[model samples]
Target: MADNLNADLSCPICIDFFTEPVSLECGHSFCRDCILNASRAQGEPTGSIACPQCRQNTARLAIRSNRLLANIVEGFQRLWQPQPAGSGATPAQCQLHQQELRLFCSEDLQLICRLCWSSDAHSQHSCTAIKSAYTACKANSIQLLQKKLNEYRDTHTATGLKISETLEHTNRLQEQMAAEFAELQHFLQQRERALVQRLRAVAESAVNQLVENMALISERCVLIEQALEEIQSTQEQTQFLREIKGILQRCDLQTKPALKTPELHLGEFNGPLQYTVWKQMLNIISPAPVPLTLDSESASLDLVLSKDQTMVKGRSKLKEFSHHAKRFSNYGCVLAREGFTTGKHYWEVNVESIDEWIIGAVKESIDRHSAFALTPSNGLWTLRKWNGNIYGPHHATESECCQNMNLQKVGVCVDYEGGQVSFYNADDMTHLYTSTDRFTEKIYPFFLPFPETMTKGVLKLFHLQL
Candidate 1:
């Protein structure tokens, strides 16, 4: 049973039964010291030992001390200390060094003899003094592990701080952005309210103006109807008088009756009743004559209209004029003098030409007052002349003439010597109302259709009907 148990026992290095154990490439093995010692004696390094049986090397310098084996050997040596008188006891020897091992050192836990220590192989090597090297190596390894742990902890702390700071900054920026958005919304709302209020005010003013214009136009229509009625009545009276006159002419007063004769004489009605009535009607509707003397003294001529068809002259010149001035074929016509013996004279000019023409009312007539005598090269279009009156549609009445009135009916007039052409309001002048429309070129001439009743020397009157 003991032999069976021993069979299972193993050498620590080979982890197998100790039989011819050999050293390894690292010079560490079991039962290879004797071969290693012999190799060393042949000039091999002390640590380099080999096994003859297995041809393996070992570190001879490493002390191999087996505690259990030493205990068993000691027990056996004690039992055999006293022997029989004639019996001989064999001494144990180290197979590696071929020497006896006498001492067992507890400090190194190695078995050694005095001869081995004194031998050249181990003579210079220090004897086993203490076992503190193992404890020191273990302590140094623990310190290195602690340093690595500290480095990892510091790195983790720094990374965490950066993450916190980034989050805080992001939150602050988001709050600022939100505040800006709120302010922008408030500003837009305020502007919107202001704009709405301004638009309302403008709309109200426009509506009031429109209402006033309607009232004025309605009054004008009533006066025109009354004038027509008066004309019809005058025509009827003149026809009656003509019939009575014919009857008187046919009756013979020479043949006399003998008893109770009555003397009858037909008196001729000399006055042209119809013509007189028509003339009176015309005067009522006609624009009031602006006196030449007054016109000359005043800075400008002001023309105002009443519901009774009376023209009132105010202190200001016609605030507006017709827009078709550029279309007049006779440029001189625009400067014609009003209230001339010829009749009521008027002309038109383009809106663009007004600034170049005589601005304000004529204070004094220039020597070359005739519109025809004025030439385009002389810049006479920019000066006032005596031939005609310039009028705008808006200036037909006071209420209609607004500073913001559409420029469509504004024009200047020039009247020269004989022939005259007057341009009235027309649709082609629509461009003046908007800034986007550009006037790139000079305006051409436009002629007014003359009425047959208007004699060559007589001035013609033109009015805006619509």
Candidate 2:
């Protein structure tokens, strides 16, 4: 109610309690000074004065001091005291018109009286019963609040999902790191055990040889001592001479074999331990075991496939064999008999005898009948030796020219899950190159003997040492 009372007394111009009230022809009231200032300023520009509330024009700007209304305002001022909560005995009335505030102005969204609605200021504005307006607005407010609540809920759900993904990623990284550490630990233990075994074998072999030599010498010494005893007991000169001659012939002291100690050719353990462990990782971390053989069905016509299918030689004249659809008709390439689906695999190739060769893995369905570019994108992951230089796929020039002409064997390893394929020097376990690619289908070992103009090279599968 106090809210209603204060709003009525508020000036439309100053928006405060009206001072020395005045009324114009339009019946809208304002403070005396407020009306005069507005009228003078408005009429000075346009010869007609307009009512501030409705903008209605009039011939005159005569605003008379509302003495009767002023006196009423003064009398009512004493009654304009603040109301306390729930003092619902008497309803608050409009201080301007002394009317009950029963109507709600939809445009202003506030309570008003019948007199306020009658004025041009609110005549065109939508008005309704205060109770009806409150009911409709409350329903809309509830929906709006619920919509805001749903938005917050969606935000929380998104935040939670992000948190879960982050945690999962963190755990995966931790697992991979842990597995690598465990692999290193296991490899170190295995290496230590192998070295210890080798040391024992070397020591045992040397000791056995020395012990055998000692036994032979002991027997020879006993024979010499026996000869001396017999000679000392001999009374005849011929017997003594014959015994001495026999002893000297049996025991040739001057011609005794020289004692030689076997040198233990154990490899140096004092170099970089970390480097050694890292190199061994390549041998142990294979995705799968690949014992491969050349597929005779996929061999080129110029290739002579060995009976064991473990070797192929490039020849000038095409070999006499039954033609097959799977065989390469245009290029010197061959695929392995077996293909890998997943995991890691390792295989070695003896390329020392071959003058030129291309060795790596390839997708099983690679194009083999047409003239093709040997690149990774073309399903080939190979390293080539041409003109005594080593090159990879799609390379224009040799990345590493084969400086060591004595280079021979190379080991290839693959990891499907890790999407890695690496080549190494087989003799010294030295890294040559590594290619990284995701596998979409089964991959097979690829080999080619790039024979020189004068020499027909051979590509042979290297057998396991043990």
Write model 2 residue lDDT over 187-221, tens digit each, in one string: 88888888778778888888888887888778878
Any runs in candidate 2 off by more than 4 Å, and if so which? 1-9, 36-48, 58-61, 82-172, 228-236, 254-261, 268-277, 284-466
- Candidate 1, residue 35: CA error in Å? 10
Worst 10 residues of 1 by lDDT: 431-440
lDDT of 1 by residue, 192-290 (tens): 566466566655666666666667656655655654554446557767566644443333234322322222211212246445444444443323222
Off by over 4 Å in 1: 1-164, 184-192, 228-235, 238-466
Q: lDDT score, residue 93, model 2?
A: 80
lDDT (C-alpha, whole model) for all candidates: 0.38, 0.74
* Candidate 2 residue pairs in clash (backbone atoms < 3 Å): 287-343, 287-344, 288-344, 288-345
